[model samples]
Target: MQEKIIDDKILEHMTLENVFKIINDNIFPLLNEKEKDFCRELQEFCIELHPKIDKNQDVYVLFPELGKRGYMQRINLWRDFMPYGMKSEILLATHLSCLDSQLELARLASGILCGNPTFQHGETDEILKVQDELMEGSKIGCIGITEPNRGSDAVNMTSTCRKSDDGSHVIYNAEKVFTTNGPKADYFATYAVYNQANPRGTMVQAMVSRDFKGQLITNRLKIPYVDRVHIAHTIMNEVEIPVNYILGDNGKGYTNLFDGLVPERLGIMGSGLGICWATLAYAIIYTNLRQQFGQNIINFQGVGFSLGDLLARTSSATALAFQAATSYDDNILFAEHPSKEAEKWIAGVSSQGKYLVSKLSADLTYTVQQQMGGISVTDNTDVQELSSTSYIEEVIGGARNIQLLIIQNALRRYSKLILS
Candidate 1:
């Protein structure tokens, strides 16, 4: 006996192409003409590339492909890519996540996590060269901030660095866990403190290159779900970095670290947005076609109402993400003298938005899975993969509690604003 095949039209409608159609219907109305065009190009590119990916292999192999299309990142001006800004970066993340969440994770680590610092703070020729390499995807990058014991307390780093006698070099002896893309990274945006007791005044950020002489060790972490994207535990012993490689020197590293967080959280929100949209779109299509009791499951009140509720929440979260991205672009990215007040407001709202959307991604995917039933767990669809990745959404960028803590501190500051 042979397995029965599903109808060709049903198979075609379930593809990423159809997913793009659903995504455009929901999201294009909110975008400007240029933004819509960018999304369309990304959609077409994703459609063409999706069939070529070997899911079992490392996603790093595809970096150059993204680089060729100027898709590695969009937060800052890379070359001649138009409409470059925070919103564009968010859109890039959204489409990339929809294409492959695992690849999006690695791309974020290499492009935004490492490349962003260079664009924001770099001045020297060497650092600019590093930027070009990263943007061009000739090299891979990762950030080292999290450690074995120091996770949430990022400011209080256990990793230590020292200045050489000539002051031309910074030496690091550090251990970093959860170093996404570390196993294959050519450039590392690593942070350390010269004085742990005075980290705020003595922290340093360096762009550590693999070609540099040092005992740099990276072992792939056992993150089974996102195996397509490497994560590692990296140990650096006396990694000597030239002063020119430093993106943030002395106390400036503290400020740079926090500055990077806003965009990082926003990027995560965009990825979460894609997860929400992709999973919901898949469920909508699946339920409408799957029949029970001689009728489509989507027509049943239970399935229909639940999906409707998820869609409403997903749309609301997307609006919040776009609103935040737009504000950041207008005030920070494009402003001659960026508004301090808007910066403060956006910093707080980033936490709020990240918190809401990350959790929503998980909830929406899980609920969609339940509404979708057993087929969702199979390889025939993307729902399970989305759900698996969504499970980690609340924990990355900053964990759920961390986002809440930031929001809580902001809430406490409201009294001061009220009195002033």
Candidate 2:
């Protein structure tokens, strides 16, 4: 049998063209439509503009729109163009092309935060970038560390990577749960504990492409709305990939995970800020337009006071999210971890900001829904959608409890500084 060879340009074009089309036609149109609808609804409801909320909502609806708009043709261009950009000069200089440039990666992360299915939708690009070899029409890459059994504890992974004597390949066996983009990913950045030497030694990061035999199992996760976010699971049954497919050094996968998580946390915080802004905007409009006792509700001291409190919270949350983003952007330049002291402070602040905004969004959304009275419960009502989304924001990308734990951990590290 003749070995099949993959053409780089063909792969690149297939990836980039599809993504570009998806974004320009599907994502952008839906964004514009939603923006117009949301703005008009707010105006009719007499609400103020909330950029963060607007951006987040735009992201949530972008996935289906990409499918609808047939823009998958040019989706991979950003991934290809990004690594060579000025921001990623250092990474590009190293001749690394497996992962995207930092800016491109950031853009992709941002798209995901906004609920765009760039990861799933741009699978072709993912494969071209991450995998060394590719087969035609292959799906893109995915990250599948999280599981139904082990949530945050990556060390407790049940997956195992066993090396063969030939040293040509490694066999991977594990069941991964809660995989985002699992169903569609052609390749996977999979984390598994290698048990060849000793079962309790260290974890290894391997690149497992879909060409290797594996099963994508869909477990329907119930959310409040049909248009809610999507997540999935993947079962790897003795999947095989080249021995060279390992990422970083063996046993250092956790470090990579930690480094990656900092940015992920910041990204989630940004989305939360957006949700908070949206909630406050909704509350402001509802309080003004709603009438009780023959006068607008805003005229009532109680209603005005509640809205004022939410506005104050929104402002504080915005400031915190901004500060955290700034810190993260700056830290990207530092080769080492920002001073442990600084890291602790920033982590604490970011966690607090995320939690505060999440809570405020939830409270404000509820208050606004109540102010809207009977209409708030209906699916057609804008307030209902806004309220439901607020809850989604609270749970997605690490919940309030998780943020609190992060804050507590950071605070523990800073205890001596405070005492001094």
Model 1 spans with C-alpha error above 4 angstroms = 1-9, 418-420
For residues 27-50, could you state the per-residue lDDT of candidate 1 as single tens digits?
888999999999988999999999
Cα TM-score of candidate 2: 0.64
Overall lDDT per candidate, in order of appearance: 0.89, 0.47
Per-model TM-score on C-alpha atoms: 0.97, 0.64
Clashes of each: 0, 23
Range of the 10 consecutive residues with the lowest summed lDDT in candidate 1: 1-10
Number of clashing residue pairs, candidate 2: 23
